[model samples]
Target: MVNENLATQVSRILSKHRLKINDRTLKRFLTALESINDVLTPELIEILVLDNLTIGESYFFRDRKVYNFLRKILPSKSDWTVLSIGCSRGEEVYSFSMVAKEVGANFEITGLDVSPQRIEEAKVGCYKFWSVRFLDENELESFFNKVGDKFCVKSDYRTNVTFTAGNFLSTSFDKKFDIIFARRVLLYVENEGLAIKKMYDLLQDEGLLVLGLGEYFPQVLEIFEPIAECPCVYRKIQRKEIATTAYKNVSEIRKTADFTAKPRAENANVKDESKKLKAQKEVITKTLERELNLEPALRVVEHCLENKKLIEAENFLRKLVHNFPTHYLVWKYLGILEMEKGNVRIAKEYLKKAAFLNHLDDEIWQLLRLTKGNG
Candidate 1:
């Protein structure tokens, strides 16, 4: 028997969050709701129990291929750290610990969930016999000891696992780990881009990042190269630095290398050198123009200012303002750069143009005061 109103509400919530809830699961949830209502008061139900209902179902070795890959790659005796994000009720963490033990690996397993109540329940290390319905009867019997009717996790295996409460929205980093298991968590997040970026920052260099089977984001894959494809897991690709040499210096080096060449080819070489130099100058000019062409190029200007390259950046800004005189933000940025170099007079002129274009920016008032003081 299902409560139609409750079922519809639950369905609506699931749909709002972009989660697919089958009719069967909705019916089961309705039955659970009825059972809870029978025991608990309405106020308590409204306050706590209803919002914290666990929807994700799991089993021992849920993805056999992923487990197999883990078993194959992981060393037998080494210090390894694994983070299981959105781990509900400790089942996945326990399963990981069991697998690590079987593989004879020395490891630390951490389970994180947003629900404090679920974390407390997970800390107890007890579960109902039918909770692991996906496991074989023999396997369940072997892993659990009879504590009345409920199956409790063995004590020896329970010591290595720890549970913590965490939220993905906060940008906090405590320690980097070797492997982060974020399976089935991304589907629930509002902004998948930020979540993927956060996960990238959390993982250490050469660390493995595992995701669920159906979960796929192209932007994530573009940033992180796929190492193991079948299980659809990806590892962060180590960024490589591009080698840069000054064009003039490269030409000089080439000339030195070919110093003893014949006279007839010397003319051709000189012409080539002239063409290369012209091309190099053109490139440099274009780059400078592009760097200055941005409106309110705060990031670029900041970098240049830090490196004591304000003159170069200013030169670019001057050309940029000449090309686009109406760009108020660029004028303001140019004013800031000029102020940085102690050119108060020139800075005042740029500030006036910026203020005339857009008088709303408050910082221009301060700049005007500073310029007047300098005068």
Candidate 2:
């Protein structure tokens, strides 16, 4: 059952944030609201509800194919401006940073999300082990530093990366971007046309727009053309002129790669079979890791917290802390859980432990300060 007054209030709040909530999500939102303690302020309730609605699961180098495509097409240019839409916890943004560094491109990236809490987490630039499961030892060493079982993005990667909390449709930027990554975001947007218009306006002429697999916008094909050898990637089509030498190369590559007719078949069945076996092996390994990893347990705790199931969230956090003693996030969340329960002393103690583990976390320190005031 849904409370009509509360449902209307939630709708009003979401509308003010430029977010459209459908009936299904609104129902779930109301159910989560039922677990809220009356001690919470209206502002805290708003942040909690909005944050839950915007939460997403993500990790670095999520799609290997997309990163490989980006590697090939990233022009050798200076001062490239990139925007990552719905950059949940900053993994994608840092992944792009590593790509730009490898390609020797001078680039700055901005990550935007509707959740202020997620934006704060992105600024921290620390991640759990599961987030870097795809990276090998060498890649880890190159891009991150280990701090008490947590991996922090290196100083080089963090230098030019910035994060903002706002709705993209309502937010205005002073400058346009060369590349925009809006993967799987349109699926949730209520007005697809308005969202597309916002993206179109924010992108420079002939800029790149990268989308997730299976996402398509045929109506806007006149403004954006799919690039060759790149899946789900489109280029803004305004002027019919090549902007740079690298872009000219892209055009040339597309022209030469199209042979309209089949070429002579080569007898390489054995080699192809071996490649298929290797790919299968990789998929199986990823599956096994997904099941065996503790990251999913953390996500479960997050889900519990989002639903305001404090006791359930606390139980999971305790188990996680026992198994992963050095994982500061577990401690941090425990602190937050206590704070939400109005136990300022316990919250401060838990937060102190978290802060000691990762001294660089500004959010933890801020939380500690808040707990002190509450105490």
Candidate 3:
């Protein structure tokens, strides 16, 4: 029963936070909003709606490969500044603190999320069983102290971590960070391009931008390049070098131009040229189709995986591999799928192929080692 007025209000509220949801979900939320007490103020309604919509699903060390890579590359001598965008309940920021301590690196990490309740919970530094489910006995004992039935973060780990509840797109920072961990965050943003540009601006020259696995966007390449060892990690391009590179590219293009070439012979040669153009057009069309299909196909595979439809996910992944043989993601997911199915040896092979495609992909290497251990 959502009318135009309610829809407009919902749109305005979501825009204030730069968030987006499918139309069905929006309508559901509006319907729920209508049933609420009429005595509530507009501000209270906004807060309640946003809190319900906020996604705070996270656990400690959710992606081990990402943290392991961070530990491997972080220099001990430098004082690092890290930012965790969409850091649900602060696990990620604290994980970085633990890594910094292990590597003897001086660091300060900031965790930013849009949910005030989440921020308050994060500041408390207490977690329930589900949040710490992945931690081993040693890690749990070292990082947390059991209080009653809950585990609380040790003071040592909490010293340099700060949590703030603010929308990333609207919040301003006085300083740029050396690393920004924004995994799975941009997917929720309505204006993803603008969000990316904001991250680019807030990142120092050569700063790291860490994303969730399989999260790819074409616009990111304009300002960042994927690190050799981590396909999900990108390094910001230096501003001055961009100008120089553009000038060099323009010069090279001018030098390579052959605009002064004489006209070709007629008839057969013209037909031959037309045939060549048609062949080239076919190639371009195929390539374009693959490019367009890649994201949707991956989403379907992810949906299958989430639903534990391993066989179906594998079928789609196999097709993706056949179509995009050189794509590292195809091989990576194939390896992951095989591992999920308990085919350790087959997983190893797929991971090895992925490593060959992106030799520096740390996650691939990590998965390969994991396969070896499981085998």
Candidate 4:
């Protein structure tokens, strides 16, 4: 059973993207989250969500039969554009380049994944032995160099490829592809129907779509025609549109799942900005109380100093001394402000008159001596 509080919080985030899971899954994932981090901060929560959803093991030539299927089925278009969704760690992309070359297909590949760590690794064009384990001897000889224990992809297969980190369900790249490899991704999504429709729309006319063997979506078949002898691949045939009523019912289900995720907790940047703004407000309130004079509100000025609002205090005191030249505390604080600003000569003049107001004041005495010594 999922604890109500944890379920509520996790579901809120999931629902915004039309996703949900059983309470049991949430409980186990939450336990994993707690084991990793003691505090439930927004950063930790973001890490948990992204880590769970985007993580997948990938290696070169994974499911080689799929690549062979694509090579056999390539359209005659001179330029082929392929979108590799969830191309974790870039193994698929480098592998695709080799397959495209063997079939003499002129193509460009775009790799997208939701994991920042994976996207960065993809861009680095370097891979550990684990990621290239399936590379046959000839492929190893032609496409990679053994650097220490890892393999680096030669530039020929690495060109015309780009990697970006993004959420698949929420954001869409505004482009179409002749082929979209969405293998292994739909198994993780709650709304496979929605994802399939999205991929369908992303395809060019009669374009091809492939999925992992484990993923299945019978409902979305109205838009995609399955290919013979390809267990999980589909060719985008002319639309056999669903009835309007059924489409509306699906829309309503999505709307029911839609929820507003809570805004993240107040962060350090927010707290510091709040303090700085509050200090500024206090300075304004106190400055106004003294009729903009630095005479009676020295405590407010000191409050600004204590808060390290030297810019605000200096500006206020500069204005105050300009209007009330003979005000002792006004001149005294101006001297202190200038001293902090490293203007010892100017500070000496202000301190001399402030000391004249009350020669016996120990603070004024010390300030005067400080200005003179520093000068």
Candidate 5:
């Protein structure tokens, strides 16, 4: 059970920052707070909980397809260094080890996690039998030695791997790596765009950054193109190189004059326009919600409208006006969505309600005239 005062404080902090904290997350927050409160005070507890909450569960060769891809593309070098960020226990780092051994590459692997206890456990390199389920009996016997109830990594393999406890937000190393495997860590960060920019700076020229199969970031995708999609991996291309490549591709297509080529440019422009509209809609909706105590229905309607989901936006706005008759902003947005949908009669009705609430705005008067003309 959580202390009610503590839970309220946590909730207030999250809400003040406009973060969405659902019931499940609140429970996790409470549990994490209780676990670390003995060693940390209230002020430091949130930071510690945030650091320890990022440990992701993994299995041996969790995604075999990604490993297969790595086997193909990883350079066969005598001295390569690989960094795995947020490597929870040792599974992914060990997976990298297995791959390196198979490719006959002499490699050093560093696995960093935020939890000191997890780092200690990883240093021991001892795991339960079930953790190696993917390995055959002979392979397991070859790679690990039985130690009491657990299996310890074989000495030959153990020397190449090191586990360190470090926070991703503040940690830095003097050396650049040939490969940085950040996997699913970025999705949980408070500022993913800034984090990606930092990661981009850490990569060597032509170096690889492998995000996990299911990981997706709109911000990262804008900059990094998919080099190999089989494993859903991305490579950090130099900005100048990407520009040069695009220029060459465009020049070639222009010379060829293929009808299929025009659509690609048009699609790029459309995507840019869509992004701008979405940003505008978010600004407007957030401002209104924060300043006016507007209904959530109106905000959802505005989002859908900005994303060009006209029918859904209209329906949502109509529902808001119907359910919350006293909310003027709901009526205002309903009118806007209706106008965008070319339904002037419904738009006029909604604009009337908005006019009743606040008659001072010139824009409202202009929209009312336009709606009346259409009706």
Candidate 6:
């Protein structure tokens, strides 16, 4: 029989890592944890539990579009400082190094993740073929040397990119980044508003905050302004500017507001100003809900990703792509999945379809870069 007390303790620990497990999953999870290390030291328990529970998926050159866009907008002559939050195994940081070199821009990139094992792997700078499948043949030849079955990163790429392991919420940085890549991270955070505010504080003035496609929260508007041309890009602005934008948004809502409130029966022609105003408010609320309502299918995919359930995640994305036909984001994520799986040919086909449907997504554009060359 499973000890209820032990099970509760495990649940509390995983909760700190932003996981909420049901009683059944908890039982199965504890079984596996015990099988790995029955001694169950506090540190070991935390690590084992989180390793199985946290949200993490990564690859070299995973999102090609984001880098391509950065290359164009960032000053090539400046010394660029970039940060990748929740950088699992450091593919994102390494990708930026390659981008800087290709763009002929001097740069420093820091990758931060909470898993110590991931940090250790990143420090080793060696990866299985699966982790770097997105890099074309030329990139693979240029950046890595095969040892047995794994590839080790060359010295040039490893020199400036540093990996740190810690809770990002409690960590401190000495300097702000010119750009921060926060893709696919917020969905796993318990207090997303606080996490986002911290990201804003970590940016240089007017620095860019890149989020996952279709990821937005009301709190984001309080600290940043969306770049109109980029689907997931937001730029930090002064508080005054945020206030002005908020005011304009309210005014625009009012202008578009309409009502069917019953007026005085004797003077039905005259509108009840208060009821009309309430109706306008209702309309605004409904519109906001419609806009932020993430597709249920996509949420399922995120949940699968969080748990490292690749098959489920892939299946969900494939189904969404089939059902919606032109749902570009699903196509984009599906392509990312294939790239991670080392299927470059199929990945390119899916990514190209995504780009054709939604050209502005920086995520899709970046991955397309690899298909051009095998070496």
By TM-score, the best candidate is: 3
Q: What is the C-alpha lDDT of each candidate?
A: 0.65, 0.74, 0.77, 0.69, 0.67, 0.71
Candidate 6 segments whose C-alpha is farther than 4 A from its true place = 15-28, 34-37, 247-375
Candidate 2 overall lDDT versus native:
0.74
Worst 10 residues of 1 by lDDT: 241-250
The TM-score-based order of candidates, best leading, equals 3, 6, 2, 4, 5, 1
What local lDDT score does residue 325 receive in model 4, on the 0 to 100 scale?
Answer: 70
Return the candidate ranking by lDDT, descending.
3, 2, 6, 4, 5, 1
Best by lDDT: 3
- Tens-place lDDT digits, model 1, residues 1-375: 577665566655554444444456556666877776656554444324223443445545555556777786777438788888778678888887777777888888898875566778789878764355435446566676767656688876787799986555553657887888887777666577777777877887777788765455655643564553233466775544112221223455456546666465654655564565455445434543443334235436546766879887787667667776776667777888888888898889989988887664556777888899664
Q: How high is the lDDT of residue 224 in model 6?
A: 69
TM-score, structure 2 vs. true: 0.63
Residues 168-261, candidate 4, lDDT per residue (tens digit)?
8777677799888888777667888888888888998788887764355555454655564554566775554324212223333344334334
* Tens digits of lDDT, candidate 6, 238-298: 6675454332233333443343343334123222333443444454445444433335466
Q: Put down candidate 3 lDDT per residue, 156-178, tens digits, no spaces.
A: 99988999999999999999999
Flag clash pairs in model 1. none
TM-score of candidate 1 against the unseen true structure: 0.51
Who is ahead in lDDT, 2 or 3?
A: 3
For each candidate, how many residue pairs have backbone atoms clashing (under 3 Å)? 0, 0, 1, 0, 0, 9
Query: How do the predictions measure up, each by TM-score?
Result: 0.51, 0.63, 0.66, 0.58, 0.58, 0.65
What's the distance in Å from true for residue 57, model 5?
1.5
Instruction: Compose the digit string of candidate 2's lDDT tens values, residues 1-375.
Output: 776666767777777776666778778878878667455566876787667775567788766667887787666556789999888789999999998888878888999987888889999999887677556557888999999978999998887899999888888899999999988677666677788767878899888888765465543443565664554677786644323211222233344335444232311332333344344334434544443335567668878888899999988888788988877778888998998898999999999988877665667888998976654
> Model 1, residue 208: what's the lDDT?
79
- Candidate 4 or 1, higher TM-score: 4
Where in model 3 is the C-alpha error above 4 Å? Answer: 3-5, 37-39, 246-375
Residue-wise C-alpha lDDT for candidate 5, range 1-375, written one tens digit per residue: 886767776766444323343478668778867775656565565444434444456556655666787787665656778898878777788888877787777888999876666677778888875466445456677778888767777877777899998766568888888888887777555566777777777877767777765555655544454553343465677878646444222234344344455677655554454454355335434543443323235547768978989888867766666666766567777788778878889889889987786553345677899876665
